[model samples]
Target: MPHARTAPALSLPIQDARERLRVLIRDLAVVRGRVVLSSGAEADHYVDLRRITLHHEAAPLVGRVMLDLLQREGLVPGIEAVGGLTLGADPVATSILHASAADPALASLNAFVVRKANKAHGLQRRIEGPEVAGRRVVAVEDTSTTGGSVLTACEALSQAGADIAAVAVIVHRADASRAAVEAAGHRYLAAYDISELEI
Candidate 1:
């Protein structure tokens, strides 16, 4: 028989965890240089948050910080699941799921993945993991530029009968992204903005 895995202990206080995550993101994820963004726009720097989101140390911190953010913003109570479009949001959603396991109040929180397209075979499901029907969910992403990706996830979630509580991200790169999400009628929450990253 296989042994049951345990949730990792929440070691740092939320404030400490958030600060540590900020430093890690600043040091590891911010790439300073001319680059084209996913929206095909040119920028002087790029925030490739996957570097920290998928990191061993930083990933846990991400969970802690993000969970705290949701709690502080009062978005956690009825949020049954967290996720966004696949790829960028994959590790972020998983991190939140793992972190929630360490907290009694949030242990019921689940994670889901929004596939770019429905699986051709099997159940032909567009959203993977636990069922999200009729449950309130928060969409998560590592970074948002135009909010297109997260919005896409929200659309699929709505189609599947899930109520979108809000959209959250580790970094908010453009003000336009926030506007776009709000224009779509969902609250936008970001743990850090580019100014805080000092890039």
Candidate 2:
């Protein structure tokens, strides 16, 4: 008979995972050049976090680091799901969901997606994957400059009867984002900032 194969452990110490993710972001994601942002602001450089968020190695680290951030901040307990706007937040939310699966304590965590707009036909829903109604969920993003994307998701979530636990991100590039999220009455958390990436 063939022997059964065992998978390797998926969890890591929070600090180690966080440090590794920081290095990966600096090396793989940060692009140095003048460019206009979605927020309509020009900057000397841009941090394109999707590169790391979807990377094989960095994706696991993203899950661990983001989960740890929410855990330490005391937002994970009552939270039933995690997600934000589609595209950017999809992988981030999925990463966290996968990471949570490795830990029984976080096993209840699930993921959802907020569409840019409600589908015109069929279900006509804006939020997808596991109903968020009446549940507490954390909004996630790869990165944010003005907090607009996460906030948009939060609005949809609110309309769906979900309680916004907080907003979390992989990288926080601007102070304005923090202010914007807080102004909208949601706690803001980030695993890393641009300065921590040594950029």
Candidate 3:
């Protein structure tokens, strides 16, 4: 008779990711409130992703979370770079960059950013920092209500001949933004969504 095959032992309970995300949000104080989105419309809730992403403790956590997500999907494709829109994407991109620094497989991931508008002088480059042409990149942002900034950055990166692998957000507003990303055919990963983080 053939030997029976058994599944590998698990280390934790199900819904572990969701529960951890909720606790992190609550601990970081990501909350709901009236605010304007990148699309210039009033919103019932706002996720000040900086409240978490900028924290000394939160930064590493964000990195681990993103790395875990990619790992779970069995997607370990290396990124030639990581970046997004200027202000909102700053911290999240930095977190990815810092995390990559500690991992030998990801240490080559360069950091870059897109300007809201061209400088009109000097280099006049929309993309600043390491060259991104012909590279696979991961874009990150703080919050997305309409997904304008993320799209804009993607467009610029594409125009520069880049392959956008995925996008990561600190908090997903769970509105039209998700649809926008799906429409563009890129995987979207969020640390927390509005309903999940609401008080």
State each model's C-alpha RMSD to the native.
4.9, 4.4, 9.2
Q: What is the per-residue lDDT of model 2 for residues 1-199, given as tens digits with 9 covering 90 to 100?
A: 9755322226455776677778889999999999999999999999988899888788888888898899899987779999999999999999999988888866569999999999999999999999999999999999999999999999999999999999999988899999999999999999987898777
Q: Would you list the clashing residue pairs of candidate 3? A: none
Give me the overall lDDT of model 3. 0.72
TM-scores for all candidates: the values are 0.94, 0.93, 0.79
Model 2 CA deviation exceeding 4 Å by range: 1-11
lDDT of 3 by residue, 1-199 (tens): 9755422112223245346545656766554578776588986765666777776555566665665555565445566677899987877777766766766764445679899888899989989988888887878787788888898898888888888888777677766888898798887877666766655
The better candidate by lDDT, 1 or 2, is 1
Q: Write the per-residue lDDT of candidate 1 for residues 137-182, one digit (tens) a residue.
A: 9999999899999999999999999999999999988999999999
Indicate whether candidate 1 or candidate 2 has the larger TM-score.
1
- Rank order (by TM-score, best first): 1, 2, 3
lDDT of 1 at 193: 84
Q: Give the candidates in order of lDDT, highest first.
A: 1, 2, 3
Which candidate achieves the best lDDT against the true structure?
1
